[model samples]
Target chain A: MFTPLTVALAVAALALAVWCGWAAYRDQPTKDWHFIGMAVVSVLALAQLAVGIVRLAGGEDAAEGTVIFVAYLAAVAACVPVVGLISLTERTKWGSLTVAAGAVVLAVLQARLHEIWGGGGGA
Target chain B: MAPETPPREPRDPGGGPSDSDATARRASNAPARSAGIGKGPGTLLVTLYGIFTVGAASRSAVQLATRFDEAPLAYLLSAAAALVYAFITLSLVRGGERARRAALGCCCVELLGVLTVGTWTLVEPSAFPDATVWSDYGMGYLFIPVILPVTGLLWLRRSRSHGGPAAVGD
Candidate 1:
């Protein structure tokens, strides 16, 4: 696992969470720019997903359970896009909060991924 | 999104000739069609439940497939929890008087599951070598399992009393 990518994803996810939470606080829905932010984070997650698969194929970290590792990798990649779609349907402050919640969950998943990768679980 | 379909009129058992006109009046008298249980805060609840459905389902699936023998009870409980979450999520999305009632009932059941599992895990830790989604009242997941059902019940009850139409089999 690339430590830098995991770190970057955690940071980006938390940043997205704060940004979307601010939108909710202001009684605003997720606008286009917010979707863009979500896309950016999702792109990063995709990159992580690819790297994780490659690492798994190369048997870089086999002790942490490959099935669970692959599942988390896939889940992290899918998180933001799914939440973004749901937010698009719900055009309200709650929609913004939904994205915020997704971001937070993604961050937590990122930490879990780190742990699974045997990164010492230091978030 | 298009406005939710206005609830259909209740059918008359006698099949009277004037049933159509009566049904039309009844439909018109019904409250706002958009007051779905899946609207407003219900959206957030649905989102959370959707995430949990995926999370718990996948987690349990992997666990059950890979090592069911290690702790069969815990893995089975996780799978059951995932099913409950998925059902509640669907019921919320399919909002109406019936769906609301169904969701309400499911929420109570969910709350009961969480409490029972939470206490069981505490009182007999050795009984479960692996943790379930409802273990320790969902402490591992920030207690969202316990909180979600209570919130869901409140939301469902609120939607029901707010005159959400009683659509038959909708």
Candidate 2:
């Protein structure tokens, strides 16, 4: 319902995508900056999960298939945590990069989800 | 001081074609157990491939199950493409002599699939209604399917030497 959460998630995801691309372009290990960017993405993703569920429960229909919308929400929601866990096990810069990149994918998909709910394509 | 990636040892991608440092880095994707399944680029590639496999498979299934009669050729091609994605994912995660060969073979097939299917889709529009993984050179996926094999072939070629038992799946 509220776009604040969606906007936040998309923004964070976009920022991180940019950051990660820069890091990769420089051929550098993902660093503290990467983690910070990822943290923001993760928080926003969680918010999306919360808001999406509420939107769905409020009798709103997903113009792009409710099942797919829910699936995308769940995917966007759990992606950060799942990748975070995996990254923790690695303890390498690549681990951070992995998590960061995962968030970028999540954000991209979340935008798509919004389009689905709005009955439109990407902005 | 500016951050820098560690100096990478020059390597190979196993039994495939082409050559490049970028492709060689895929060789670092150690077997699932030793390096863990999520270790290097291979892990990421495998995960991405797995997602694609799922996406393609579900798409085909949904299309076929709901409206098979509408576009049988397109749906069938979707199923086939999904199978190829699954096959490539399996071979990568499996990582053994057999797996390597399987991956190599699949990569080759994937290339041919995209090429033939791509050309055919344009030549015979009547055949495909919507789209398939290999349709019009994977236009839907931005040709990632087409590019994947070339990368795969190069990676497999580079991995051939150090690719012995270390390539075995966990």
Candidate 3:
């Protein structure tokens, strides 16, 4: 994994999570701005995914097992979209909270992914 | 979806309703009338549980498939934790009186499992060559395994007080 990309993804995810959490605290449902934030984060994750796949195809291996690494990659890639769908199903402040939680999870996963790739970062 | 309507209180046959009685009825019915376990805040809870179910199940499956000989006990414990999470998630989404009871039972079991396994892992590090979901009180997963059941129990208790028509209040 690219360290800079990973860091960027984690930072973006955390920023979005905090924003969503603030909105939820104010008793607001998920708004267009939240989706936009998610889109930005998703784009970063997709880039990371593409980079990871290319590296794997080029015969690079993660320090951790390839299977679990790939699984985490796919999970990170899918996280935002899945949470977006869940938010749509709920049209309350809780829905925003759900998205916030998802973002936080994604951020944590990104950190784990970095460590799994032998980046030596703390989780 | 439209918000759930409160059920009308059964009228007294012999006399007109007093103001205090109507107030009492409304108060008692308020929370019960809100939503089933599958809706509102319950939706968010179920979503979190669902994520853990998938995460724990996949992790154990991978560990068992690849390195079972290394840490069979820990891997098996992880699998069991996954099962409990799955059951609780299902019950929460099912969201009837029966489902609530089932979830309550599972939550109790989950709390016991986490406590027992967490303590055991701490007391005997050699026993767990690898960490299970409950190891160190779920430190690996932000201690969610330890916290989830406590939150679940509280929610279940609140739901019970709101006692649906099919629910037998404790």
Among all candidates shown, the one with the greatest DockQ? 1
Steric clash count of candidate 3: 0
- Kindly report the docking quality category of candidate 1: acceptable
| Pairs with backbone N, CA or C atoms under 3 Å apart (clashes), candidate 3 | none
> TM-scores across all candidates?
0.85, 0.74, 0.86
True contacts kept of each: 0.40, 0.09, 0.31
Local error of candidate 2 at A67, Å? Answer: 1.1
lDDT of 3 by residue, B1-170 (tens): 22444433322222222435445456455555423665556667888899999899999999999999999999999999899999999988766566787899999999999999999999999999899999998888899899889988887777667543223111
What is candidate 1's lDDT per residue for B63-161, written digit by digit as tens? 899899999999999999899899999987876566677788889989999999999999999999999999999999999999999988877775554
Stretches of candidate 3 exceeding 4 Å from the true structure: A119-123, B1-35, B164-170
The alpha-carbon root-mean-square deviation between model 3 and the true structure, to one decimal in Å, is 7.2
Q: How much is B70 displaced in model 3, in angstroms? A: 0.9
The stretch of ten residues in a row with the least summed lDDT in candidate 3 chain A is A114-123
For residues B1-170, could you state the per-residue lDDT of candidate 2 as single tens digits?
Answer: 11222323222222222434444345444332212222345545565676678778988988898889988988998898889889988877756555666788988988888899999999999887777788879886767788877877766654565432234211
How does the DockQ of candidate 2 come out?
A: 0.19
Model 1, residue B165: what's the lDDT?
A: 26
lDDT of 2 at B118: 93
